[model samples]
Target: MSTNPQKVHFIAVGGAVMHNLALALAKKGYQVTGSDDEIYDPAKSRLENAGILPQNIGWDESKITDDLDAVILGMHARKDNPELLKAQEKGIKIYSFPEYVYEQSKEKQRIVIAGSHGKTSITSIILHVLKYYNRNFDYLVGAQIEGFDLMVKLTDDAPTIIIEGDEYLSSALEMKSKFLFYHPHIALFSGIAWDHFNVFPKFEDYVKAFEELAEGMPKAGAIVFDETDNMVDVICEKERADVAKLPYGAHPYEVKDGVSYLITEKGKVPLKIFGEHNMKNLHGAKKVLERLAITEDMFYEAIQTFSGAAKRLEKLGSNAHTQIYRDFAHAPSKVEATTKAGKELQPDRELIACYELHTYSSLNKDFLPHYADKLNAADKAAVFYSPHTLEIKKMPAISAEEIKKAFGREDIEVFTQKEELENYLKAQNWYESNLLLMSSGTFGGSDLNKLTEMVLALPTNKKEKAKPAAKKGSVLGKLFKKKS
Candidate 1:
C-alpha cells in the first residue's frame, strides 16, 4: 500500500487474470516473483521476460524466506501447498487476489460490475466508452478485451477504478465473495441465476451471494440492477435501504436488417449485436455511464464500435449464403438468449445451431432440462459434448442419448465424438443457412475457425446425390427426421 515497490510473490501465476495483475504490478516497478505447479506458454514467456518466471514448476518453499514482503494466493493453489505453509510459518502477510485489488484501489471511486452472466461484456463496454471519451480511470476486465492489454490494471492518476466483479469466493483463505472486498462506490449487477454449484451448492445460496454484494456497499454508494430479472430484482429490493439504488430494464429497441437499434433520446442507435438480453446489457452499461456523467451521445458513439469481447458472439467466418459465429454461452439463460438472438437476427435464414454440454451443471442430467425449448428458435439444433470431460471433472458419466433426451428435441442430433460431428458438418449443405456454435468450451478439440471456413466455402446448392447420403440408413438419419 506504499510507494516502496514491495516484494510480492504470487502462489500460482499462470492464470490469465493472475499474469495480467503481475504484469501491471511489475510495470509499476514492484518486485514481483511467482510460482506455479504448471506454467504454460504465454504466461511462461511473459514471466520470463519480466525476470520472474520460476526456474521450474511446483512450490519452492526455499524461495519463501522471510525476506519476501507478502504472499498473494491464487485460487488455483491447493490448500496444502508447501510454499503457502512456509509463508504462513514465516509470519509473512497474506492477501487474496481480490483483497490486494481492493488495497490498490481503496482511494479511488470503485465501480464493481457483477452478475451471473455478462459481467465481462459490461466491463469491456464501460472501459471502451471511458477510453473513447478520454476519461482517466483505472480498471479491470474478466476477459481479454479488444483494445486493452491486460484484464486488470492500477494507476496512480486515475480517479476511478472499474472492475469486473466475480461473485466466486476469493482464494481459499478469503471465503468472502471477491466483489465484497471492493466495497464499490458505484456498482452494476447484470443479473443473477444459479451457477458454481460446486461453491454455493444451492440456488438460493447463490442468489444470496449477490445480495451480499449489494449489501457490502457504503450508504453513499450506488447499485444499478436489472428490473426484469426476477432474482436480481428481488435481491436489489432487499439490499440496504440507504444506498442509492437504480433499476435498469430492457432498452427501448427495434431490429432491422439483423441489427438491433436502441432508442435513445439523441436518436436510434444501431448495434452490431441483436437480442433482448443484449438490450438489457446496453441499458445496464448506460446506467453506469450516467453515474460517471457520460452523456447519451458519447455513450452511443463509443458503444457503436465495441464489437463485444473475444468469444462472446465472435464471428468466425461468412460468405454470401452462410455465416458462422462462436459464443461463450453455456448457462441456461445465456444459451437461450444467444440462440434466440441468432435466429431473430435472420428470421428468413435457416438457423443451424449447435451447443456443447461442457459445464458441470450442463453435463448433469438434472440441469439439462433447463435447456428445453431454449434452442427451439433454431431451425436445426444439435448438442455436442465430450463424455471424457465428465470423468476429468470427476463427475458422473453422461452419454449422448441422455443429452438428446434431456434436450427434449426428438430432432436434435447428439455427438460424443467431435470428428464424427465435424465430418458430417463438412459434408452437409451449408448454403442459405446461418450457423451458431454455442459453448463455453471447444467442441472436442475441433478448430472452430478452420471448420467454419470449410463450411462457409461450400457452394450454396451442391449437385444432388441420388439418395443423399442422409438416407434413412445413413449416419445422421437415426438422429433426426431431416425435415429439409
Candidate 2:
C-alpha cells in the first residue's frame, strides 16, 4: 500500500471482475494500466472509455517497470505470462485478484458470502439493503448489480466491505481457493453443491474447500449458513466452539397473483424477487443484516425495491400474457432451483424451461447424472449444447441419448443446434406460458432480448391451431440424429 496515488498494472485486465477492479482503482486516482491478449465487449468498451485500455493487445515487458506500485494478476493469465516474468525479475510486488481484494479490505470488517449456487444473489441483497439505507460500505460482488457502477470497490473511509467469495482457484500459480484468502470476520455459506469440476474433481474435495472456509473464521467471528443444506449444517455444527454459528431457512411467504410477499410481524413485505431459494437467500441476508444492527423495519423497507442481481431470474421482457426470464444457472442445483421458482411464481402459466449445458462440469459425462429430475417441474423441458464447445474443451463427444439418459427423463428434448432450438421455441404459443432460459453461457450466442420480443409478438390466437406433423427428415428429426 502506498501513501501516494498507486501505480497499478493489471496483467489480464479484460476479465469481468478484473476490468471492473481496474476501473475502480482508476476512479480512486490510481494510475492504472493493464494488458490482455484479448479484450471482449463491455470490458473492452468500458476500459477504452476509462482510457485504461492497453495501447496494444499483447504483453509488453516494458510496461512492468520498477516504478510501478503493484501488479495485479488476473486468473486468466498464466504463470509464463511475459509481463509477469518481467515483474518477478524486477522484484515488484504481485498480487492475485483475490489476494489484492483481501489486501485492500484487510483493515475493514470483511463479510464474505460463499456458496456454489446462491452466493451472488445473497451478496446482492445485502448490498442492496446497505445502499438503500445510505450505508457507506464498499463491496465486491460477482454480478453487475443495479445502482453499483463497479463490481469491485475499495475506498479509504468505508468501514466495511462485503465480498462475494468464489470457490474457484485463485490464479494459475496459486492453487488455493479464492475465498480462503479473505479471512472473513463474518461469513455466510449459502449452500454447497459440487461445481468447477475442472478444479475440484472429487465431491469430498469440493466439500473440504468449504469446510476450510468455515474453520478459518476468526475466534469471535460469526458464520451464517443455509440450514436446509445437510452438508452445510454438518460443517457449521462442527466449526470451532469459539465462533458463532447462525443458520437460516426459507422465510415464511405467500404468493398472490404471481407476486410474493414476505410474512412479517409488522406486516406483509412485498418483494420484487421470488422463489424458494431466493426466500432462503433473503433469510440468510437478513441474518447478516441483523448481525450488523440493521433493524427488521429497515431491512424490509430497503428490500422491497431490490429487484435482483442481473441474470438471476431477471425478467428480460414481458407482455400482458407472457413473461421471459433468463438466469445464470448452469449447475444442476441452480437449474433445478431456478426452474422450480419460475413455475411457482406463475402456477397458472405453462412453464417451458430451456437449459444450456455449457460449463465444464455440466458437459462432463461423469457430472451429467447430477441433473437427474432437476427439470421435472417444467411442463416442457429442453436442453441445448454446442458441439463446438465440446471440441473446444477437448472433451469426449456426448450424444443426445447420453444427455437424455443422464437426466432420467425420456421425454426431455435435446438440441445440438441453436437455430433448431430457437425455431422450436418460436413455434410455441406463449399466450399463457412463461419461458425460463438457464445457462452459464448464451444459448450458442442467441440474442435473448430479440428472442423474447419474438415470443411476445407471436399470435396469441394460434394456440387452438394444431401444429403440423414433423417431416421424417426435418430439423426436429435431426435433433435425434445418431452420431456416425
Candidate 3:
C-alpha cells in the first residue's frame, strides 16, 4: 500500500450505498471524506466511528482539493451541487457509483446480475454459495444477506466480483443505466419489466436500456438468461454470435405442508425460501455458478442453508398458523410474484396481500393499469396509497375506485390512511392465514414490528375452530422447533 493512499470524496455520503462505499474505501487505506445535506443513522454512527463524519452536515466546497484522486458522486447529489462543481473545477475525476465499482474491479471477472426484479436475489444466492466454499471473490449485493456484513465488497486479491446490476440511472450526471457500465464477463439477465416511470416513461423505452446492455456484451462473454421471458430471449438471441447464450428456467421443487424442498437425484434439499420466482432465480444462479466452476451438487449443498435476500419475501414474524412477510415489491411484476409465492407456501391457508402504491409510477393513474390481476392470487387483497405521498410527488390524486379497478378486483379494499389499513389488518382472522405486506415505502411511517405484534395478538374468528397443530415429530414441527 502506498504511504499516502489515494484520496477520494463523496458528495452525498448519507445514501445507503454511498456511505458503505466510503467506509469500504476507508478500510482499504484511502483518505475518505464526504458531505451530505442530511445524515442519518446507521450511516451516521458508522461514519462517525470511522472518524470520517463531516464536521458539518451540508456540502463544503473548500473540502474539494485539487490533490483529490477522484470524486464519487451519488444519485442523491444533484447536478448543481456545489461540491460537484468544485470537484469539476479542480479537474478531479468524477465517477458514478457503478463507474467507481467498475474502476475498482476492472481487472477481475465481473459477473453482473441484471434485471428489474430478481437481480438482488440471484446475486445474493451466488455470493452465498461462493462464500460457503471459501471462493475468493468480491461482491456488490442489493440487500444484506445473513452471512455478509456489508452489501458491497471490494478487494484487490479477489479473482471475480459479483454485482447486482440495476437498470436504473447511474447518477444525475450520467443519464445511462447503471448496468451498462459493468461490461460483465458472465452476465445473468433475470427478467425485464417496466419501472422507474420517472426515468423511462414508456415500456419500450425501458426495454431499450436492457437491449443496449445486451448489444454491448464483449466477445466470448457468457450471458445466462431466463428463456421464459420473451424480452430477455429476444435480447439474448439477437446478441453477437461470439457471446455464448446460456438459458435457464425454474428449478424443479415441491411444496409440502408449508415447506418447499428442491428435488435432486440424491435426495430432497429443503430450502429456507420458497416460490416459483425464487426457483427461477436459483436456476439462473446455478447456471452462472456452473460457468465459475461450481458443480450442481456443490450448489445444492450450499443453497440449502441460504435463507434469502433481505426484504425479498423476508419473513418478519411467524407463528403456527400465521406468517407475515415484508417485501420490497413496489413494481407490478414483483408484487404479483411475491403474492403468488405467499399463497404457494401455504396452499390451505388464506393469503391476505396488502400492497402500498407508494412509488411514483404506482401512484400515477396512467400506470395503474399495469397492476391488473397482480394481486389476484391472494385470497384477500388490499391496496394503500397516501394522498400526502401523491401531493409530495406532485402527481394527481387517485381514487379508491381506480385502485380497485386497476387491480381487476372489484371487491378489493383500498385505504388512504395507514391507521385505517392497520385497523383492517388487525381485524382480520389470522387463524390459518398468512399476511404479505408488499411495499417500498413504510406503510405511512408505521412501525412494522409493532404492527406485526398487534396482528399476532389479535384473536381468531370465534365462528371457526382452530385447526390441530402439526404433529410433534412431523417435519414441519421439527422445522418450527429449530427456528424457535
Candidate 4:
C-alpha cells in the first residue's frame, strides 16, 4: 500500500503467476526479491532476466526483514516456511497472491470470470477484445494469452481490472477460496462442475463455494451466467436477487471446412477457435463486454483473431489430412466437452482422443467412475497415467482393469508407460484423422510436437485399415459386435 518504491518479497516465486507478479512489481520500480526451492523454465528464465531471482534455492529468514514493506505468500509455500515464520515474528504484513491482487485492484471496477471450466477461455476473449479496442485495463489471467506478455498485470491508473477467479484454495494458510476475496463488481459464472477434490471433498461443498461468490457480490453489481447449467440457474435464482442477473448460452455458429463461423446480424464471422463450449464461453464474454459498452461489432471483430489461451485446445501441429491438438482438460466434464468438440471439428475424419490422468482428482480411484463414457465420441480412446506419479502422490497403485472398468468401455486402452503410449500412437495411421491429447500435466515430459510430427510422417498405406460395418440385428452382427 506504500506510494513510494516498496520492498516486496515472494515466498515461492517459481509459480506461474508468482514470477509474473514479481516481474510486474519490479517493472513498477518496486524493490522485489523472491525465493523458491525449485524454479522451472520460463518462470526461472523470466525471473532471472528481471534480476529478481533469488540468490539461493531454499528459504532464507534473513530476507524477511522488518524493513520489507509486505510479504506476498504463494500457495506452494508451507505454513512452516522459515521466511513466513520470520515475517510473522516481525509483525510484518503478509498477503496471499489473491489477497494482494485484490488489494491492488480494490478501487477499480473488477470483472471476474468464475467457473470450473472455460474460465480461462472466457477471460482470454475479454482481454483480447479489450486490447483490440485500445481499452486501458489491467488483467490477471491464468494462462499465457496471445498479445499479453505476462499473465498478471497491475498498474496504478487502470479504471478496470479483469480477473480469472479460480475456485481453489487461496493459500496454505488462508484455506478460503480465492474468488471470495476478489469482491467482483461485475461477475460471470460459466458453470459449476465438481472439481478440486482435495479442497472441496463434497459436491455440495463445491457448489456452495460458488454460491458464496454470488452472495458476496455487492448490491447493484451485475452477474452474467450460463443459464443452460441447472446448478447455475438454481444458484442465481436463489442467491442473486440483490444483484442484476443476466443469462447467456451458445452463440449461433456453423462450422465450414473445419472452421467455425459465428452467425451474427452483421454476417458469418469466421473464428480461429472452435468448439461448442468455446462458443458458449464466447457468449458469456460477449455479455460481459456489453456491460463495458463494447459493441457487438467490436467484439466480433476482435474475437475472430483470438486463438485461445495456451494449452486450451491449442493446435500443436497440422497437415493437410490431419491435425493435432493438446488441451488442458483433466476434469471429467472438460474431457467430455473437449473430446466432443475435437470430433465435431472434422466429423468426416477419424478422431483419436488420448487423455492422461494427472491431477489429484483425476488420479483418485474414487473419482475415476465420473469419466465413464466421456470419451465415447472418439473412434479410438486411450488413457495414460504414470505409475511414478501415483507413487509420488502416495496414492495406491491402480490397475488397467480398474481404469477400463471405470470408463465402462471394454475397447478403451490403458498405458502406464509414456514410451509405450507414444509408440502406440505412432503405430496408428493418422491420415484423415484428428488427435487430441488432454491433460493438466505433460504426458511424462514427452514432446507432443515431436510425437505429432512422427505420426503425420507415417505412411498411410502401411497402417491397418478400417473394418467394414455389418447390418444391424443380424445373427452374424450379434456375434461380431455389440449394440450402441
Candidate 5:
C-alpha cells in the first residue's frame, strides 16, 4: 500500500521499461526520482506528469547519498556513470532493473513467456484472460495491452505475476540475461533464434540463455515449450528430472471463408486473429494458462475479442481496394514468421514485404548470414535502413547489395531515402494486393498509417472478366477471394 515510502533513485530512467517501473513505484507511494541525458517525447511527458522528473537532464554524483535505500540502473547507463560511481563509493545498494524485478516478484507465482518473437503476444494473451476473469495479478509486459494502462505493476495484494521475459542483459554491470532473474515457476519458450549480436556475438552463445532457464528450474515447476522449434526442443528436452516439461506445437485450425477457427473437441472456437504463427502462439498460451489452473473453455472465451498487442500486427490504414499492415518484426526468425504469416492469409495475392535493419544484431555484417532466405515467402521484398542511424550507433556502413546478398535474394530492393521509398510506394499498384511492413523501428519516421491510407485510396475498378471495370467494390473483396 501507500504506507511505506522508500526512496528509490533511477539512473537513465527514460527507457521504455524504466519509465514504466518508476511510475509503478511512485504510484505505490514510494518517493521516486529519475534522470536521463536527454528525455524525449512521451517519456518526458510521462515523467513530468508523475512529478518525479529531475530538474537537470544529466546525472549528478551529488544526488547519490547513503540516505537513498536503493538505486535502479537502466541499460542506457554506462559503467562509469558519475552517479553510479558515487553510489558504489558510498556503499549504497545498487540493482539492475531485472534484479529489482526479481526482488519484487519473489513472493508471487511467476509465469514467464520467453521467445525471440511471440513472447509479448503470449504474455498479453494470458494477461487478457486473467483480466477477463477479474483475477488479481502483478505483471511486467513489453507492450501496452488494451486493459493495462502501464506496462509494469507491483502490488502486495496480487499473488501472481506474469512477465514478458526478454533475453537482453540487465545492464552494463550485470552481464546476465534479464529472464535469468525471473526464475519462473512456470516458463514458456515459443522459440529461440540468434539475436543481440552486440552481446552474445555467436549463435551458440545466444542459444545458451534458454539452456540456463531449463537447468535452473525446480523439479516440480512446469516448463512449456514449442516442439516445432528445433533449438527450443533441444533445450527443454534435456531438462532436470524433477521439472515437468510440457510441449505444445501448432493448434490444428482451418481458414474458413477468410477467418481462422480453432478445432476443439467441445466446439470450433472463432478467432479474430489469423496466421499459423498465431495459432502456435495460441497453443503455447493455452498450455501456460492451464498450468495456472485456467480452464480450457475460459481461455478460448477470453481471447475471442483480443485484437492483439498494439503494432504487433497493426492496421495502419486500408481502403476497399488494398490493405496495409505493419509489424514489430526485426530479428531473422521474426522476419520469416511475419512474412510467411501474411502470405498464408492470401495465397494468390501479391505480398510486398518491407523491413528496416534497425536492431544492432541485424546491422552487423558478421551476423547477416543468419537472415538467409528469410524473405523468400514475400513476392516483393525491400530492405530500408538509414546510414545516419549506423553512424549514430557507431556501426560500420552497410550497402543495399550487402543486405541483398546476406538475405540470399537477388531481386531484393534496398533504400537509404525515406522519401524515395515513400514516393516509389505511392507509384505502385495496390489493387488486389497486400502490403506487409516489418521493422522494430519506424522506417525513417515515416507514418505507416498515412502510407496505408494513401495505398488504400488507389482507384478501384471492377469487371466480369480479368480486364479492369468501372469503379465498384473495394480491394478487400478481391484479396478475400484470392485467399479462398
Candidate 6:
C-alpha cells in the first residue's frame, strides 16, 4: 500500500453497484469511506468486515474534507444531499459512478459490452475466459459471476478492462446514460429495445442513446453487433470509416437428450448452458475474444466450464421431470427471448412461465402493449405486479382486465397479491413440467429459494424412472471429434 493512499468518499454507498465499487476500491489500497441513510445486508456486512462501515447512517458534511482526493456519488444521493453541498463548497472533484470508472481505467484498453439484453452474459463470458487463461484483466459486470468475488474490479496492474455498459442514468446530477461515459476502444452492441420508460419517455429517445454511443466512437475503435436485430443492424449501417464493424449471429449447436452442444472444428463441445440467446451471446463473446487474440480453440475450451452469469436462466433446483429456473428478465425483449429459450430447451415439457411487472416500463399502461405475445411460447403464462409498486412509482392504476387485454391472452393469469400468485403456482400439476420465474425485482418479496424447494418436492405422475439416452459415439470417437 502507498504511504499516502488516495482518499475517496462515497456520498451514498449502500447501492448494489456502489457498495461493490467501495469494496473494490478499498481492496485496491485506497482510503475508502462511505455513508448511507439506510444500509442493508450484504453491503452492510461486507463494509463492516472491511472495517469501513460508517459508525452512523445518513450524510455528514464534516466527512467531506478539503484534503479528500475525490467524492464518488451514487444515484441514491439527491442533489441537495448535505455532503454533496459540502463537497461543492470545498470545490472537491466529484464524479458519477460511470465517470469515476472511466477515470480509473482511461489509460487501459477498454472493452465495453452494450445492449438492451445479454450485456451481463457477454461480459461474464469474456471475464470467465480471460480468467481461465490466467490473463491479467479487470472488469465491471452487473451480476455476480461464479468465480468473481465482487461485481466490480479496478487495479493498477491490469492492461485491459472489460465493462458491462448499462443504458441507465449515471447519477442524479448527471442524467446521461452510463455507457456514454465509457468511450470504449472496443465495444459490442448486442441489440436495442425500448425500456426505462421513466427515464426515456420516447422510444426514439431510447434509440438515440445508442445512436450517440455509435456516433462518438474514437478512431480505430471496433464494434461487434448483432445483425439479427434489425434496430441494431440499421444503427450500425450508418457507417463511420475509422470504426471497424464486426457482425455475429447465433453459433451452430444441437440439443440431444436434454443437453446442448456446440458444433466446433475440434468436435462436439458440450456446454453447461443452453438456448439460442446464449448461443448468440457465446458467438458474440468469441468475436470480442478474437480481437483480444484468443483463438477459437481457446475460447471453446474455456467456455465449456462456464455455467452462466447469475440470474440469467439460473437453475435453482431440478428433478428428473421438474426443473425450476429464475431469470432477471423484465423488459419485453428479454421476456420474449427468455421464454422462447426455456421452451426450446425442453420442448417436450410443459412450460409454466411466470413474469413479474417490476420495471417502470413494464408497469406503464402504454408500455404494456409491447409485451403482447411475449409469453405466447409458454404452455401456461402468468403475470404478477404489486399495486404498491405502482403507487411508489406514482404511475396510474391498471386493472387485471387491462393486463389481460394488453397481453392478448385471456387465459393468462394475473395476480396483484403475492399469496395469490404463490397459491396459484402451488396448485399446478408438476408432472413433467418446468417452472420459469422471470423478474428484475423479487415477486413482491417472495422467498424464491423456499419456493424452488417446494416446487422440486412436488409429486410427479411418472410411474417408472426414465432411462438415460445412449451416446452415438464411443470414447475414441469423442477424443477424435473434429471442431467446426
**Predicted candidate 6 versus true structure: per-residue lDDT over 186-304, tens digit per residue:** 98999998889889998799999999999988899998999999999999877897899999999999998778999987799999998899999999999999999999999989999
Tens digits of lDDT, candidate 5, 1-484: 5676888999999998899999999988899988889888678888899898889899888889788999999989999999999989998899999899889888889988998879998988888888999999999999888878789999878999999999999898998899998999989999998789898987788788888877888768988999999889989988487888899998989887557898989889888777888999989999988877899888888888887887787667666556678899989888989888888877756678898999898888877767777888887778999998899889999977777777767677899888977876776677667899998888998887777777787665542323222222224333333542
* Deviation in Å, model 1, residue 70 alpha carbon: 1.8
Q: Each model's TM-score?
A: 0.92, 0.94, 0.94, 0.95, 0.93, 0.94
Candidate 6 displacement at residue 137 in angstroms: 0.5
Pairs clashing within candidate 4: none
What are the Cα lDDT values of the candidates? Answer: 0.82, 0.90, 0.88, 0.89, 0.84, 0.90
lDDT of 2 by residue, 1-484 (tens): 3368999999999999999999999988899999999999999999999999998998998999889989999899999999999999999999999999888887899999999889999999999999988898999999999999999889988999999999999887788899999999999999988899988998889999999999888988999999999889999877486899998999999999999999999889999999999999999999999988899999999999999999999998998889999999988889989999999998878888999999999999977877776887887889999999999999999998888777756667899888989899988888888999999888999998898888899887535523322212323223323320
**Candidate 3 segments exceeding 4 Å error:** 1-3, 462-484
Alpha-carbon runs more than 4 Å astray in model 1: 1-3, 462-484
The regions of model 5 sitting more than 4 angstroms off are 460-484
For model 1, how does the per-residue alpha-carbon lDDT over 1-484 read when each residue is reduced to its tens digit?
A: 3487788999998987888899888888888888998888778887888888888888888889778878899998888999899999999998888899988898999999999888888888889899888899898887888877777788877899999998888897887788888889888989986777677777778887887787778878888999888888887877575788899988899888778888877788888767788888888998999999998888888788888888888889888878899899988778888888888887777788899989888887656655655677777888898878988988888766666555656677888888878876876687668899998878998889888877877766843323212211222323322421
Model 5 TM-score is 0.93
Better of 2 and 5 by TM-score: 2
Candidate 3 per-residue C-alpha lDDT over 263-289 given as tens digits, one digit per residue, 9 for 90 to 100:
989899999999999999999999999
lDDT of 5 at 178: 93
Q: How accurate is candidate 5 locally (lDDT)?
A: 0.84
Worst 10 residues of 1 by lDDT: 466-475
* TM-score of candidate 6 relative to the true fold: 0.94
Error of 3 at 259 (Å): 0.9
